[model samples]
Target chain A: MINWSAFVVVVVVALVAAGVLVTLFSTALRVGDGDAPWRRPVSVGLYVVCGLVVAFGLYLIIPALHAG
Target chain B: MLVVALVIALALFFDFTNGFHDTANAMATPIATGALKPRVAVAIAAVLNLVGAFLSTEVAQTISGGLIREGPGGVQVTPVLILAGLIGAIVWNLVTWLLGLPSSSSHALFGGLIGAVIVGAGIGAIDGGVLVSKILIPAVLAPFTAGLISFIATKIAYSITKKRERDNFKRGQVFTSALVSLAHGTNDAQKTMGVITLALIAGGLQKAGTGPELWVIVVCAVAIAVGTYTGGWRIIKTIGRGITDIEPAQGFAAEVATTATILASTHLGFALSTTQVASGSVIGTGVGRKGASVRWKTAGRIALGWLITIPASAAVGALAAFLAGLGLWGIILDVVLAAAAILVIFLRSRRNRVDHRDFHLPQPGAFVRPKKRKKAVAGG
Candidate 1:
């Protein structure tokens, strides 16, 4: 018995996550372009978020992470 | 014992081809956008593919235990049948690669196995419900879903930043493409592991319904990594330039869409084709852009290739299985014919050599209008 509901939920979540990640990455790059006072901190925070996302992806790849 | 060893060797060869054949799925957009150099991109992908192979065995378990049944009341799938199936898959992959078509290697393998099993055992060996529910349904749906997601993502990306440095988007493409590569390795490499594990079980070298052995994982990972590093430059050119001209932003969006779709499918233990997902995302981004065009003729050709891959590979598998069922002489003849076919394809490919240098070459039949001449006949 295939769980079609779970498949749909996962697909939606993946799509939203992709959209959000791209948006965030692009925004971080845009804000880091100039010497504004808020640029440094905002850029740093955004980069950290992006890095964390990647780290989370790596975590998922590790079999131990999913072990109950 | 000897046949089991040969089957293991052939499975690794299939994994190797699967690697180079699919390199374009993850790296083509990045290379097209100049986000990463061709050699550097492949090296990175190769390393990540190796790491990703060790991640999970869910897909392998599905292939070993779910697709074909064993024990009482189940049809017997012998090692010879598996060999014929692998040969069928390998031949189709090579032919498709030479033609620069991004067909589904996963489907080819599945079709080969199904064909061989039918001829060698019977249709009763296969679990039809699992084939449809797990493999077939996902194969048809994944591409469209990826395309739609990429279309939306590309549109949103353009709207947010009207004018920005290309370098920024290129940097983002590097990260996104890497994710796609990692996802590809996780998904595609496991398929070979599954086949080999299945073979081992049939040969009584391993227990039935067990996950792939440690050695199986290691060999499959290394074979795929080496193949990736070789880089299927011909298909890379087709995907990177033949479909549509890609900018860094579109590349990022496409790669992101591909990564998400493949990763989600892998999580669910579905052995979907990464090639289809990547192609769909590429087409989706092309449609998303305002003035960009997708080359319809090339796309049509790819679509046609997709439609026939399963049946064509299955036919070859069935023929090979029929021959291999005759015993020792039949097996030797099957090997000879497979080798000869591969050799011919390899020789023919040398006539139109495409490599790293030709990655950016203008595709044949690209829309180039003739230059206008002065209108002397008009008597201005």
Candidate 2:
């Protein structure tokens, strides 16, 4: 009965954790003398796609009894 | 009785590792900035950490109740499960230490525990909602909050001191360093208390829902304190000097940022990693300051280790748990593995002796002291 929901939840949580952490650390990401949020460019796309996949997997995999 | 002893031993071992693993959080900045002599800083930090460990066990209560399922059958924790986790966590710590990567010891500990629980008792044994809502939320939020706070704090520090002299700012580093150490004690040492308490509950030595006993708290605090005095120079060197150039103000800012975040989390019974928060704050300070470079390569290695520590330790824990189900031989095996691991770690650390004397010195000529002009700005 495991589905994408649990996986989604996991990915979403991880992404948020990563995102929030990275964003909070945004002030620390500036390359010497650089002010642009370089992390934004890669962070958004990377988190979205990866987050979805991870979430889907968790949703699917975690609900079952331990068959392993 | 033996099970209780083993669990207590495991908790102390974890506490010992926490003390060594997390020494940098409290001392790195001060050492880097020469605010306190390396030995002096660690010695002070070690004592305060012990004091802090005894201050509260709210977080320990949470770990006992929040992370795993508990009921009339008692805590449902097994010595083998905990031993497995300890093994996993120790291995991860050693590997990371060898590579000089600073990672979150908290996560490794959590990961090992969860992994063992899942493998041994099944997923039903976990409190997933609590995992996501409480521990996970803080774990993810804390470091970033620390980073942001450090960023703003650094900026504020920069402008206010823009008219001051530098020595005054360096002097300030000493106070902030002390706070970081105190905060480190409050946060990291409690984790050991929680684990040990969990073991006690599982072993029926204590009430299922109660906190650690006064004696248990004292022993863990002392063990961690001694471990703190032992020094985590590899991580200290890497964190203090490897990531970026930190000045007196930046060091103060990072410490303050770290302190605020950890105190809040601990109060709420959240099990976040002080090391991660400290690193993030240090990195944030680097980004806030001009001309500071974060060593991305080192950061990347640490990130990779962080990714693996949980799962890796969990696997080891699970395997250990499975074997422990075999009885006395399993305990014997766990003991051997532990003894061997300890000898290896002891031997490895001796390869490069970093005493209290050289704890603050950067690798010759590579020291990152702030410039003289900035000193004028800080003091004037």
Please provide TM-scores computed only on chain A for all of the candidate models, following their numbering: 0.81, 0.37
lDDT by residue for model 2 (B162-250), tens = 42233334554665566666667766777778777777777777887777788888898898898888878888888888888777767
Off by over 4 Å in 1: A1-3, B57-59, B62-65, B209-211, B268-271, B360-380
Best candidate according to DockQ:
1
lDDT of 1 by residue, B1-380 (tens): 76788789889999998999999999999888777888899999999899888776555454534666755677667889888888889899999999999988887887787888889888888888877776677767777888888998888788776454434577788888888888778777888898888888889989987888898999999999999988888889888988998888889889888877777776765545789889989988999988889998888888888877877788888888999999989988888898898899989999999887775543342212122112223322
Residue B312 of model 1, lDDT score: 79
List ranges where model 2 is wrong by over 4 Å: A1-68, B62-65, B72-75, B135-137, B207-211, B268-271, B353-380
CAPRI verdict on model 2? incorrect
Q: Which is the leading candidate under lDDT?
A: 1
User: Per-residue error at B225 for model 2, in Å?
Assistant: 0.6
State in Å the error of residue B154, model 1: 0.6
